[model samples]
Target: MTLFIGIVIFLVTFVFMEFMAWFSHKYIMHGFLWVLHKDHHHKDHDSWFERNDAFFIIYAVVSMSFIITASNTWFWYGLPIGFGIMAYGAAYFLVHDIFIHQRFKLLRNANNWYARGVRRAHKIHHKHLGKEEGECFGMLFVPFKYFKK
Candidate 1:
């Protein structure tokens, strides 16, 4: 029962996280909240925690509380949702902080697929001033279709 619940939690959480990533990237990061996110782009290399990554903290607190309460009361439903949010955060960390920004350069070899995709997309995003502002606003996966003129 525990294993099944965990798996379900992870999958559901993953989906929710993806949607949240997209929504937040599109609206929050690119929206009125750019002040916070702008620091990610221009600041002179600060501590990992110094970046405006607090949104994740807010998200974790809210989602964790809801998940815990739901798990205790409603049982398994909360598991997936909570896990999904976590998965999204993980993805964002990898795609946004690591690959896209070249912060985690260990996997930057031109041969690697993740390195190539994320780096290229991010470069293109940075190439334009008005359009691609900060983050790609597409999370881990930015299909070429999105960049079409």
Candidate 2:
């Protein structure tokens, strides 16, 4: 039963990360920390990397901390939570960076309805260069209106 509970916890954590992503993007990324995230929307640097990449590092550290704690009394929960966070981070990277932004030049040929919707939503969000006017949405949860037939 412990293994089942861990799996459940992992799924829950994975789902919850969507809300966390949306919240952080809307508030923190577009809020006071816009200085870090602004370059992501606007191409001011010649380098492929942006200061906004720091957010990924922050999340990696948080996920690693949970994994490290799994050796302790919190093993059951910590293990699942850590993996869940890491999984979500991976998905976010693939979808937001590679697929949507074409950072890696892969997954560009995905032209299904879901892929089109995600790309459309992200395009709308990026239409605003400034942080104040940009719309925020989670990597996996684009608005229904964006998913037009």
Each prediction's TM-score against the native? 0.71, 0.96
lDDT for 147 (candidate 1): 44
- Name the regions of candidate 1 deviating beyond 4 angstroms: 1-9, 44-48, 128-137, 144-149
Residues forming the 10-long window of minimal summed lDDT in candidate 1: 128-137
Please report, as a residue range, the 10-residue window in candidate 2 with the lowest summed lDDT: 70-79
**Residue range 38-67, candidate 1, lDDT tens digits:** 665556564766446778797888669768
The global C-alpha lDDT for each of the candidates, from Candidate 1 onward, is 0.66, 0.92
Question: Which candidate's TM-score is highest?
Answer: 2
* C-alpha RMSD for every candidate: 4.1, 1.0
